[model samples]
Target: MAIDELLDEHEQSERVREWLRRNGSALILGIALGLAAIGGWQWWQRHQANQQSQAAGDYQAAVDAIQANDKSAAGKVQALPEGIFRTLAQLELAKSQVKASQNEAAIGTLRAIRTSDQALTAIVNERLARVLIDAKQADAALKLVATGDSLATLEVRGDAQLALGQREQARDSYNKALLKAEVGTPQRRLLELKLTEAGGTPPKTESQS
Candidate 1:
């Protein structure tokens, strides 16, 4: 090689070595941090999987306890960490309480359910409203269902209206609910009965109209 070319090569090599000497620690730290992050993420995923499994097992145990008529079933359900399973368990507990003529307790349990899930919220509200109505707190039932437009909520609102002697409001609520309930379903059948009780005629089907 020419002397100038060799000198340029040597200069380039020295510059690279100097740069490495300056940045070697930072590069190594960056790689270490990257590896640590990966390891932490893997550990988190495993921990989450384990927690989900435990929650599932606890929920199943609660269900079994409830089915066996164990008095401690509610406590078992209540012990579940908050999640979908806990919310469902609370629903089951509320159902059992309502069946056992524990309307007040059922209301309390239903009210305690906290979730960001829209569907679960509707279900909880419907159940809570029904329990409130059964407890002769129709006003509270109506208030609980006031902002909800789901089929279940509307039906329960109608029941609450009927309880409050607001036949016209009950008829309107049931009519709105009937619009959403599918034909030939038990829900539609129940709405029809409720409509009749409120002296409201079912709207004509499309074919009839």
Candidate 2:
């Protein structure tokens, strides 16, 4: 409508264009960085999934080897990355080793499964103590079972104590095992016999009533 008004509007449009030109590179760079971050996160997720899949396959192979009585299962398990699957594979390998009478190798395999899980550690310790007792390393077996709270570990500790001629300690350990074991189980009966052999009276059973 007026020349002055049109001139003012033109100046404002040029100023806006000038501002966009000055900051356009920064805007583009910000968009590029955001896209790169998203892409990197996706890549990491895929990488983790692949790693987990590979670990699972390796663990399953180790399990099959153990079931088939293949001695190389232990080496296959040892090659897996540290995780729950790896721990289980190692346990299977140790079981096979023990069955095959490779006590020294089994001990080493069981010892390497030290995880942060207290329950898992207890299980490993129980197996290791049993092997040590069979190997006639009574002192080592006793030490391994010192913190053990399971019935099996307690019985093994009693056996170790008996081997070392500590009848009183053996009696105490057997009694503890009897308390933890079920009333009528064969394990309870065996613990009772062990207690009697250690010069302690067998605990009263439900059948004694």
Candidate 3:
């Protein structure tokens, strides 16, 4: 090889060595981070599986008890003390009460769900609010879906607030309900109708807030 070409090749090799010297710790750190992330994900998946298994068992027991027409027995499952287990118990109790035509007791069970599983809080509150409305407990339902409550969806919030005569607040919540794309097709159409009923325009079609 020519002397100049040899010198250039040596220079390139030195530069590569220098880069490795400076960034070796960073490279090792990146590998460690990747390994830790994978480990954490696996650990989380296992924990979630265990939780779901336990909750499922409790829910099944409740269902069996209900099928036997034993209302009190349906509520006596060995609960996992948290998560969907507790929510399942409340839901079963509510179902039993509703079956017996005890609207008051059903509302009480659903209301208990509002503070049980926080991740499922929005759904529970919405269902409970509907039960409350059906039972003519609009005032209590309104309290559960106040201006800043985190335990309800926008659509249900709007409906509950409207039932309690909070027109303006209900309008805002309907607008929000229109924004979430997760509510599709017939539900969206219904929400649009509700918005009009509340004297507001649907989202992206008008400037009403």
Candidate 4:
């Protein structure tokens, strides 16, 4: 190699080293940040998984306690974190309270539950309206159920209307509920009875037909 070519190569190598020296700290910092971000994401995923697992276990325990009619079930349900499981637990607790003739408590229990799911909210509203009716808050119950056309909602609305002495409206609501409630089911039979009590005729049964 010529002397000039060797000197040019050496200069190129020195330039490359100088560039590295100038930017090495920035490159190292970027790599460190990237690794930290990955580790943080992994930690978050694990934390979420652990939370879900714990929630599942707590929910199952609450269910078992409720089914056994344990008096402490309400506390367990109340202690549940806000989520689907907690909403479901609150529902079970409300039902138990209702069965124990604690209508006021059931109303409170049902009211405390909140969810973003429209369908689940409708179910909760139906249950809450029923308790409202039992508590003689028929006006509130009617208002709560007035917007829903579901069979359960209609039936509860009918009950509320009946409580408010709106027999004709009750009859209409019961008929609406009966239209959606399948024949031969207990729900259909109950709605049919309610329709009759509201001075409306129910559809003929198979035996009657």
Best prediction by TM-score: 1
Model 1 bad stretches (over 4 Å): 206-209
Winner on lDDT between 1 and 3 is 1
- TM per candidate comes to 0.92, 0.80, 0.57, 0.85
Error of 3 at 41 (Å): 23
What TM-score does prediction 1 earn?
0.92
Error of 4 at 157 (Å): 0.8
Q: Single out the weakest 10-residue window by summed lDDT for candidate 2.
A: 69-78
Instruction: Give the per-residue lDDT of model 1 (tens digit) for 150-207.
Output: 8888999999999999999999999999999998788898899999999999877765
lDDT of each: 0.92, 0.88, 0.73, 0.93
Instruction: Give the clash count for each candidate.
Output: 0, 0, 0, 0
**lDDT per residue, candidate 4, 44-134, as tens digits?**
9999999999999999999999999998898899889999999999998899889989999999999899899999999999999999988
- Candidate 4 stretches with Cα past 4 Å from truth are 1-16, 204-209
Model 3: which residue pairs collide?
A: none
Clashing pairs in 2: none
lDDT of 2 by residue, 152-184 (tens): 888988999998999999999999888899888
Q: By lDDT, who's the top model here?
A: 4
